[model samples]
Target: MELKLDTISKHYKDKKAVNQVSTVLKSGVCGLLGANGSGKTTLMRMICGILTPTSGTITPDGQSIYQLGEDYRELLGYLPQDFGYYPDFTAKEFLYYMCAVKGLSLAKTKQKTAELLALVNLEEVANKKIKTFSGGMKQRLGIAQSNINDPSILILDEPTTGLDPKERVRFRNLISDISKDKIVILSTHITSDVEYIADMLVMMKQGEILLTDTPDNAAQSIVGKVWEVEVAAQELRAFEDQYMVANFHHEGERVRLRLIAESQPTENAQPLTPTLEDLYLYHFQEGGTADVSTD
Candidate 1:
């Protein structure tokens, strides 16, 4: 299946939430990397038919999403940025609830609930109340619920936001495993979420689509433009004022800085391999938000 967006735009009274965005997606994991308020959620909302675009076309195959109607919804599995779950419900109850919402019969709901609880490694705690689950376990349940209908297109918004490092890695692996034959769009402000797992990445900044390419290609796009230098701890501030310092680490007495620039900032600035985080910093540092999280 192919999903295509052509010049999609969404406007609030004064703000253009999604500006002239266009792309075609196929079956695979596609990561939407962007900063907060960058319109990633709005674009995904339009794709899920929750919101209408001010201008543009979203089509599955050759038909408009509106034309597809319930047919289109049946193809989707969406987990919004702030996905809601019943705090009183057990893991099993939650999955069964989602199954019923998706219109599954009792027998199918019973079968899918057990299968999904196992798939997300939550069977051991299947009867526990959702309020007691850890962030990772809650997210795992969220994934299980989204899959209740076996959707062809899965949209996850900020899926790994509160997960710890190890849990984040585990979640990414889960997404990677499930995306084998489905079109999965995972939106996140953390570059690490998609850097190694996504098949393709669509970057956004200030409501505009910046670039769409493989993670390697996005990193390679800034080849020879990243530099690292070691300087006194106090001198790091001077470099920050004149160049885009991506990150810094302190050595015994000096600080090692990784920065991005068109030309070498200093004679000692050594070229280093570009990473997805480096590329994110290269485009978003000027936006003045802590830059996209590498952690």
Candidate 2:
């Protein structure tokens, strides 16, 4: 099952939300990482068939999804960035309603409702109203609803918004478990969300894909470019002005800075390994360039 995008673009009155972006997605988890307003949502909407592209075509295998119509949607499950829910509906009720809407049989709906609730660990509050649930609980319920149909292509937009560290880990593990034979496109600003779970990392910037590769392979793009340096508190401002700082820590009177630069930023700078956050920060800064080195 291959999903292909051919020069897909989306434009508003005066702005181009998505450039002529083209990529082939296969059966595995593809993490869409980008800063705010980077056209991640627009691209995801187009892929889910909720929004038509200004140009280009999206096809599953060889036929356009629009042409396939219901046949295409039947195989998709999308959890939007802003998922709407009935405030009065309980977790179980919401899943049941979603299953019914997806055109499942009553027996099948019941079975899925029970299964999803447990899968997301919402069984304890299966009968609690969504209005009374916490933010994390609501997010979990939204994920549960999306999986009611057991879709082959699952699209999740910022699925870890309100989750704590523990919940985030649980959600990541869940997605990893289900992505074996499925195409999962997860869009989020959190790099850690896709750091270990995603088989492919797609980085976007200014309405265009900047890089796409495996995690280990992508980090290699900035190999020997990330540095860690300890500077006096008074030098922090100058250090930040000189490099693309990815992280900073205050250690008593000194500051530890993790930065990205073409070469060492200071005499005491030590080369360090690059992580997803380092790569993400490196690509978003002024001197960042698209270097997709998969091999």
Candidate 3:
């Protein structure tokens, strides 16, 4: 399914959660990346029809979500950043309950429950209470429930937050496998997730989307513009005060500063290729510039 947001805006009292944001998400995996308070959750909620936009509209498959109501919800699946699970309910029971809430017929729900448990590799633990599952297991169970109805559009917010490295890789592969014919919006601040799975990337800051492009294109935006300068530990603070440093690492007695700018800061500085983290930090930081340096 395709999701189109036309000048969608949401407000909480005097603060705007989404400010006239407009974008079209087609079938494939697209990532929404931003720091906390960047309005990603608010935007996802509006798109899922959980929270209505104060202004503008959200359309799924050519129908306005607000006008379509439950019809729109039937085609969507959303996993919020903070999801609640019943402590007393087993994984299987929880999924079955969710399927019921989604209004699926009993036979279909049973079939779907089995399919999802296998998909998430949780068939072995399906009968275990959710309170007994590890963080990663719970996350997998959450994904299973989200896909219970085989939704056409999937919106996942920080889906890999509490997972370990191994679990994260497993989850990434699962998302890639499921994204073939659906519009998947994976929201996270983990740049590596976008690097590995996103066909397109969207960067947001303070309720505004700063950039939307392919991962390669976004990384290319800062090419030849990032510099690595090795400076004395004592001088690091001074260097950071005057430049936009994307990251830094300690090496023995010195620090290697990754700075972003149009021109090199000193003779010792050497140009370095930018990563997604560099591009994201550069665009979202306070007083940061949108200028793309091709050279």
Candidate 4:
């Protein structure tokens, strides 16, 4: 499967939510990384045909998805940041209802509901009411419901937000397994999620794409430009004032700081390789004013 966004743009009166963004995504797992309100959700919504672009077009497998209506939706599965579930319905019933809505035959819905429950590790709770399920379990059920129709493209927005560590790992592996033959777009603020499972990474800032590359490539763009310094606690404020500090922590009387600089700032500071967080910080650390030199 393939998804193409051609010069897509969205405007809200005086503010532009997405600006002439264009990219092609193929069958694999892709990560969308951005800060809150950076337009990642808006982009995903446009691609899913939930929101129309102010200008330009979106196509799935060469078909204009927006104009095609249900034909386009048939090939898509979307789990929004917040999904609703019937409070009184059992997990199995809810999934069954979703399968019906997706146009699956009765026999197919039964088979799919069982398979999805197993895939999401929610089979144990299949007969339990949704009101009794934990936050993580509900999220898993939401994912199961999204895949009822076996869509060729899957879009998950902050899918791991409320998950525990173990649940998060399970969800990550599930996503990776399901992405083998389809396109999966994961949008989240968690950097580690993309670092391990994503085949490609897309970073956005201020309604525009800041970078699109492999995780390693994105980190490499800021390589040799990050630094770590240990200074006396009293001098920490001066260092903060002089640099864009990505993060900092205290060790006894010394303060260890991670700072972004065009070049090494001090002789005592050592150059450090960049991570996804570093890349994220580099983009918005100075109120989006920091000039970044990319490869």
Candidate 5:
């Protein structure tokens, strides 16, 4: 199934939340990378049919999503950035509730409820209230609920936001497993979330689609531009002011810095393999011509 966005745009009074964006998504995971206020959420909302575009159209297999109506929703599943969790609902109850909302039959709901709880590894805690679950548990439940309808398209917005390292790994693995034979749009500014799993990367900046490429291609676009340098702790601030510093680590009394540059930033700067994280930081900064302000 081909999910296509044709010059999709969304405007809010004076702000252009999504600007003339167009892309074709296929089966597999597509990472929607952008910082806060870059309009990732707005674009996703429009794709999900929760919000109409100011201009342009979205279609699945050459038919308008709006025209498809309930038929379109039947093939789509979404887990918003701010997923509404019912604190009082147990894991099983929550899944059942979502099935009902999706208009599933009672028999199907009972079947899916058991299947999803097991899929998300929540079968043991199936009776536990969501209020008592950890952030990761809730996110697992969130994913499970979205999958209850066995959708062909799954859109997850910042699904790993609050998860710890281990849980984040689990979630990424889960998403990887779930992407088979389905189009999974994973929206996140966190590069780690998509670095290894995403089949394609759709980057956004200042409410516009910046670049769309495979993760390797995206990182390679900045080849020979990534650098690592070791300097005194006091010199760290100087590097920050001079280069697009991606990250830094305290190595003893000295500091190890990872940065991006057009050429050799310094005589002692060692060239390093570029990564998605570096690319993400570079784009959000002045280097990629994006203004990362929330406005």
Candidate 6:
């Protein structure tokens, strides 16, 4: 299965949220990485058929999904950033409710809800009221609800918002497990969460896509552009102002900085391997947002 975007655009009164963005998504995970205010959410909404695009069409298998009507939505699973829930309902009841809303039969609802609860590791708390769940557990419940229909096209926005390191890893593994023969578009600012699982990485900036490639290729974009330098703590601010600093650590009285630049910013600066975070900062740094056309 494939989902294709053709010159898709979304505009507010004074700002273009997405501009002529076009890409073909297929079975596997596609990670949408961007800073806040980027058009990731807008683009995802358009694909899910929840928000109509200002221009262009989203198609599946070469036909406008909108024309498919309810058929198109039946195949989609979307977990929005702010998922609403009945605070008093138990996890099992919440999923059963979602199943009913998705038009599942009474028999299938029971089977699927149980399966989804186990899939998200929420079975232990299946009878606990949602109001008592931790943020991570609630996020897990949200994930479970989205899969009520076993959709072929799954869209998740910031799915790891409240998860800790271990939970994040588990969530990534769960996504990978269910991604075979399915299209999963996951949007998040946490690149590390998708670094190992995503088949492709799409970076956005100022409401436009800036880069799209495999993780290795994306990291390669800044191979020789990443550097590390040590400077006095007092010079840290000045150094950061002069370079795109990805990270830094204090060493006794001095600070070691990891930055991205066209050339070494200091004589002693050493070239370092670029990670996904480095790639993210490299594109969104001051004066660095350039549109990377999918064409």
Off by over 4 Å in 6: 287-295
Each candidate's number of clashing pairs is 0, 0, 0, 0, 0, 0
Error of 5 at 283 (Å): 0.7
- Per-residue lDDT of model 4, residues 109-219, tens digit only: 889999999998888888999999877788889889888878899999988876777778877888999999989999987787888799999998878888889999999
Each model's C-alpha lDDT?
0.91, 0.86, 0.86, 0.87, 0.88, 0.86
Q: Give TM per candidate.
A: 0.96, 0.92, 0.92, 0.93, 0.93, 0.93
With candidate 2 superimposed using the best TM-score fit, by how many Å does residue 21's alpha carbon deviate from the native? Answer: 0.7
What are the runs in model 5 whose C-alpha is more than 4 Å off? 249-254, 286-295
Instruction: Give the C-alpha miss distance for residue 271 in model 4, angstroms.
Output: 0.4
What does candidate 2's lDDT look like per residue over 1-295, in tens digits? 8999999999999999999999999999999988878899999999988899999999998999978998998788888877899999888888888888888999998888888888888888989899998777777788788887778899999888767777778778888888899899999878787787999998888899998899779988999999999999999999888788877999999999999999987788999999887888787776444222220
Q: Per-residue alpha-carbon lDDT of model 1 for 1-295, expressed as tens digits?
A: 8899999999999999999999999999999998788899999999999999999999988899999889999899998767899999999998888888888999999999999998889999999999999999999998998888888999999999888988898889999999998899999988888897999999998889899999999899999899999999999889999898888999988999999999887899899999998888888877677346555
Query: Which order, best to worst by lDDT?
Result: 1, 5, 4, 6, 2, 3
- lDDT top scorer: 1
Q: Can you tell me which runs of candidate 3 are displaced by over 4 Å?
A: 287-295
**Tens digits of per-residue lDDT for model 6, 1-295:** 9889999999998999999898999999999988878999999999998899999989998889878999998789988988999999999999888888878899999999989888989998999999999877888888788877778899999888767777777778888888898899999888786687999988888888888899879998888899999999999999888888777999999999998899988899999998887787777776544222110
Following a full C-alpha superposition, what root-mean-square deviation does model 2 have from the true structure?
3.8
Residue pairs of candidate 5 with colliding backbone atoms: none
Who is ahead in lDDT, 3 or 5? 5
TM-score of 1: 0.96
- Best-performing candidate as measured by TM-score: 1
Clashing residue pairs in candidate 4 (N, C-alpha, C atoms within 3 angstroms)? none
Q: lDDT score, residue 128, model 2?
A: 85
